[model samples]
Each structure stands twice: as structure tokens, then as C-alpha cells.
Target: MDMEERVVGEVLVVRPVGKRIDASGSADFKGKMVDRINRGRNLIVLDLSDVDFIDSSGLGAIVSMLKTLGKKGELRIGGLKETVDSLFRLTRMDRVFRIHPSAEEAVLALAAAKSMAKAPA
Candidate 1:
């Protein structure tokens, strides 16, 4: 799992430099994300532009990581290739998870949601 992470002001921009996110690669990524979330850095933007394929295990790992982040913080996926996007659609995970058309847009949207939640109702 080749990855690069940086804090863009408030959001963590994590880009994986890989063509495929298989079981092995995904497990490592999940562990890293869980560790990050546990340490209180849960807001994340996953750039999937370079990732072309993801198997069932990979998708499951992503979902589990998102669940761990929960409501306090969230994981947003962006830059999905058509093939991977189709897989998410087929599994109905597209509706379950936040899919962004672009990483920049996702960062803004999720950040907005977070800010709104903090506002008084």
C-alpha cells in the first residue's frame, strides 16, 4: 500500500500510489486508517485516482474504516475510476459511502457538513 498523506489546513489528503487495492494492500490501509482514527485524526479524503481496481475485501475494509470514523469524523472517497465506481454501484455501497466527483469538492462538502453539525439547531 503505497500512500502519501498531508494535512491540507483542516483536511487530511491521503493519496494511495497504486493501481490495485487488493486484500493485502487494503488490510494494511485499513490498519493505518484505524490507527489514525483512534489517535483522533479521523477526517480523511481518500484519493483513488491511481487506483483502478478494488475487490470485495478492499471494499469491505473501506466500509469498516468508515464505520470506525463514525459521526464525529468521516472518510470521504474521491477520484474513483469508472471501473471501481461501477463496483461500488453494483454493491450499493455508493449509497452507503460518500463518493465525490473530485477531491477538492469532497473536502469542501464534508467540511461543510461537519461545520453544520457543530451549529446550534
Candidate 2:
């Protein structure tokens, strides 16, 4: 699997270019995400539109990455196929993650949420 990353202001967009994100590729991607988070990149939007397939290993990788990100930062997954979407729901991970329709939407959602939190109640 191949991965590309771009930073849009404080938002980091990580796009994995591959047909599957299984054991063969999950480690590298997870490591890269961990590195980014360690570098103080908080807001991460994982663009999963290109990924039409993901197995248990891939899911585990993502779960691990989410933990590395912790509370100070977050990992928002976007553009899930129906199967992938169903997997998340079935695994009960949909509640743990913030899902977005697109990478742009994820970025915007984070911004809006941050603004709201900073605003007076």
C-alpha cells in the first residue's frame, strides 16, 4: 500500500492509496499516522474513499492509531463504502469514531466543533 499526506493548516489529510489496508500495509500506515501525531499534528482526516476493502487487520491498525492519537487529537474517517461502513457499525466502532462524508467535510466538522467549544455557552 502507498500513502500520501498533505497538511491543510492545522488539518492533516492522510490518503492511503491501495486496494486493501490489511496486514501487509496496515503497519506502515499506522506508523506514519503515529509519527504525525507525535509531531503535534492533532486533527487527522483519513480519506478512505479509495479503500473499498478492509479486513480485521486493517480495522485493528486503525483502532491502534486512534489510541495513539488519544484525546488531545482525533482521527476522523471519511468516505466509507457500504461494506466498510457496515463493518464499523457491526464492530460497534461507529460510535467510537467520528465519520464524515468526505475529507473536506471532516475538516470542516472539526473546525466547527472547535469553534463551538471555544465559544461562550
Candidate 3:
């Protein structure tokens, strides 16, 4: 499973290049994401536009990544294609994640959230 990692301001955008994220690749995906979180990348946007398929293991892997953040950071998902979007909706993962239409929109949303967090109450 090949992934592209980039920084959009303070958020790290991770885009997996593969068409499928199944049991064969979930472990590696989780490992890489954990490593990134350990390295202090707390703000993230997972861009899944290129990915067309994911299994339960893949979904678990993503949920694991969110847990790994554990109040230290945020993980937003974006660019979900129709089938994947349906899966997320069906599984109720959409409610668990802040899904966006594009990576740029996800980054902007993160930025806005950060700004709001920094605002005085």
C-alpha cells in the first residue's frame, strides 16, 4: 500500500494511492499512521479519493488510527468515492468521522477548528 504524505499548513494530508485497502494492507497502513502520530503529526486529513475499496479490516485500521490520536490530535476523512461513501454511511463510520468532499476542504475545516479552539471563550 503506497501512500503520499504532505503538509498543508499544520495538518498532514495522507493519501493512499492504492485502489483497495483490505486485510492485506491494513496492518502496514496502521503501522505507518501510528508512526506518523508518534512523530508529532496530530492534525491530519486522510484523503481517500484514489481508493475505491476497503474491507472491515481497513475500517478497523482507520478507527485504530483515530484512537491512536487519543485526544492529542484530529483525523478527518475526505474524498470518499460513492461506493466507499456508501460503506461508511452503512457502517455509521460517517458519523464517527468528519467526512469532507475534498482534501483542501478538510484542511480548511481543520484550520477553522484550530482557530476556534484558540479563540477566547
Candidate 4:
């Protein structure tokens, strides 16, 4: 799976340029995400606009990425296609992830959340 990466402020937007993230590609996807997280890419937005299909392996890989970021970083999902979105909903993974309509929207949302976190109560 080929991935394109860009930075929006402190957020890294990773767009996988493939249609499927199945068992074949899930390991690569998970490895790359882990590498990024280990290298300090904490604020991340996974843009899935091009991905229309994903299987259990893919979903598990994503969940692993979230666990890898536990209490230290965030993994936001964005631009989910209809089928993928449905899968997330069916599996209740939608509730586990902070889903956004687009990568830009995710970036903005993350920025807002960070600011709110830092705000004086």
C-alpha cells in the first residue's frame, strides 16, 4: 500500500492511495503507523478517502495503532467511504475512533481539541 503524507500544522495527514486495506496490506499499514508514532508523529489524521474496502485485519491493525498511541497521541479517522463507514458502524469501531469528513476537518478538530485542553478552566 502506497501512502502519501503531509503536515497540517502539527498534525500529520496520511492518505493511503489504495482501494483496499485487507490482510495483505494491513501489516504494512500497521508497521508504517507504528514507525510514525515511534518517531514522534503524535497528532495524526488517517485519510481514507481512497479506501473503499477494509477487512477485519485492517480494522484490527487500526485498533492496534490506536493502542500504540495510548495516552500519548491520537489517531483520527477521516474521509471514510460508504462501505468502510458502514463497516465501522457495524463493528462499533466508529465510536472508538474520532471520525471526520475530511483530513482538513480532522486537523482543525484536533487543533481545537488541543487548544481546549490547554485552556485555563
Candidate 4, superposed: residue stretches over 4 Å from native: none
Write down the worst ten-residue block by lDDT for model 1: 6-15
Per-candidate TM-score against the hidden true structure: 0.92, 0.92, 0.97, 0.96
lDDT of 4 at 2: 93
lDDT of 1 at 23: 87
Clashes of each: 0, 0, 0, 0
Error of 3 at 93 (Å): 1.0
- TM-score leader: 3
Estimate the lDDT of model 1: 0.86
Per-model lDDT: 0.86, 0.86, 0.95, 0.92
lDDT: which candidate is best?
3
What tens digits encode model 2's per-residue C-alpha lDDT throughout 47-102? 99899888888999899988998888878888888889898998999999999998
Candidate 1, superposed: residue stretches over 4 Å from native: none
Better of 1 and 3 by lDDT: 3
TM-score, candidate 2, is: 0.92
Summarize candidate 3's per-residue lDDT along 15-50 as a digit string, tens digits.
999999999999999999999999999999999999
Q: Candidate 4's residue-wise lDDT over 53-76, tens digit each?
A: 999999999999999999999888
